[model samples]
Target: MASPKSAAIAALRRQLMMGDGLSPSPAPQVTRLGIAAIDAVLPWGGLPGGAIHEVTGPENDGAATGFCTTLLARLSAGTRPVLWVTAHDDLYAPGLAAFGLSPERLIVVRARRAAETFWTIEEALRCRSLAAVLGEVRGPSRTVARRLQLVARSSGVTAVLLRHDEDDAFANAITRWHVVSARRDDAAEDDSDARWRVDLVRCRGRIHGEEGYVARWFVEWRAATGDFGVVADLRDRPDRPAPARMAR
Candidate 1:
């Protein structure tokens, strides 16, 4: 059962999702992540447009990039142009293609500095012509994050913040997601599914329990359907011996 506060948030979310109880002509459409279980937990049935979302994963492992690419592929399905702002120039065009983002639909802006990258991201977010704007940033301050959120709300474009490490201090983002490469399911070696351990670290509009309602999901990407499916609920996974920390 949802708490009263949670219910109220759901109602407000519905109103926003339904165009603020007014004409629906100007309201942006919501895009489903193609995953049922994940959608069910969101305040809106799907990812709401005109909002900022954050995705983070282990540092330097490319996990964050992989997750962001998958999300971009889904968000760019209408063949809309997507602007990706990053200081790193290591993005491989071929690898992105595997995730369904073609070079023609992707515009990459390589910034020499993080500040430049964020400026480009905000500019792209304000462009109504673009479907989505993604930025690879780190240690984003609340002020900068709030600005991005504001821009996204007014432009009806989705702004995705891809962080390489754990930093969930931005309260302005609608949702924060953490993704990591999971141990491969040994039994499914022959299968084509790409497995990931996903965490819903925080949400703005939902009232969580005393423990703050963090949810874990074992998600797998099914190539045949081109969608994500929940293979297991990992909230209660058994504890194991901690691995040695890798030297920096």
Candidate 2:
């Protein structure tokens, strides 16, 4: 037996979740939108399969780079390869290398124009072997975004739309994320604390943590070599083992 209040609350929550409009009808096992607080924000705990996600903002370096890298790394966690389609060839190699990502996991393809970029993105998203598709365009239209969103949802791969400040359109996206990196500490080593504050500007039916929430990045480190890899786990992540320093 369920209490009246508790039952009513459950019903309401179910309604909200249903209103979310599930994508990738059957849902692809390989699709995951992002990690960290990002996964925590969405009602699904990850980007829905076959749905389009819009990542917008200015092209100022490091602002979107960290998130992009982290997002890709998470996508690669699955067996499928992630495709990064760019219009201007802006993907960085050193940054990626430092992330400890194997080149075999990421496919970087360059396109000359927004039109071609969108097509490439659509094709990649349609590929059953792909885990996710990253589409970067300069200035795209509402119709175009809607079309891609439809294709993404039908293809069963998460379409991560990376755009310059002017390009991203909000009309047809499953989620719109605005990412900014602030107060970066000089973490000379990997174990140091690196805080990334993410603002989930828009999520259709669920509550996003205040405007900015704390998501700590667990940077990959080579203790023996004194080097850094990509930012992978969230700080104080439940899965991370307790530091040996804290045991005694």
Candidate 3:
């Protein structure tokens, strides 16, 4: 049973998908984050498929990459391969494997220029063969964002933009996320686990009070299971103390 707020957001998303004189497509399947509280807030009960989402972090922050890799691992659970486009050749296959995304399931494309990167992402989104497309881009224009969104919708492929730029110029993305490294006091003891403070900065079709639609969570990624566990929900109480370990 969908909550009233969830239903409303779904309706709004449908309306937006139907705009620009394009015929309505069937509702897309969602990928749950495996965290109940996080899932509950999402309009589709999870991250919506056939839509474009953005993730960002401070310069040189690997937490954002870790977060996106986890998402890709989930999205590419099936036989369909995922396409990753980036200008820099910095993606480590071993590190990605630790996050549960195998190199065999990935197709990497090296585009030296921004234009080439965007073009590759758009083309990959149009291919129904891909389960998802991730592009490491910075400061994409509004026009490029819309074009990618439309293509992803038509092809039913999820698109994720991993950005390091602070520009918030893209209004067409369905969601925007900001991720940063979270420090734990016993960090040396649990060096294998990656902790992050994830902020849902923008969500289309979701309404909130003066605080806007922002939500924050402290999450820990367990290397053994390659899964995320909630450390704490900081939305309503930012100062709330996190548990010594993530909730199982």
Backbone collisions counted per model: 0, 3, 0
Tell me the TM-score of model 2: 0.69
Tens-place lDDT per residue, model 2, 75-124, is 67735588888766766776675554445788999998778898898888
Question: Looking at model 3, how many pairs of residues clash?
Answer: 0
Badly placed stretches (over 4 Å) of model 2 are 1-21, 27-38, 166-169, 185-195, 207-248
Candidate 3 lowest-lDDT run of ten:
239-248
Flag clash pairs in model 2.
50-153, 99-230, 216-235
Give each prediction's root-mean-square deviation over alpha carbons: 7.3, 8.1, 5.6
lDDT of each: 0.72, 0.60, 0.78
With a 3 Å backbone cut-off (N, CA, C), the pairs that clash in candidate 3 are: none
Residue 235 in model 3: lDDT: 42
Per-residue lDDT of 31 in model 2: 34
TM-score of candidate 3 versus the correct structure, residues matched by position: 0.84
Ranking by lDDT: 3, 1, 2
Candidate 1 residue lDDT tens string, 140-180: 78788778877787888898888886655456677788888
Tens digits of per-residue lDDT, candidate 3, 148-167, equal 87888788899989999887
Highest-lDDT candidate:
3
**Every model's TM-score:** 0.80, 0.69, 0.84
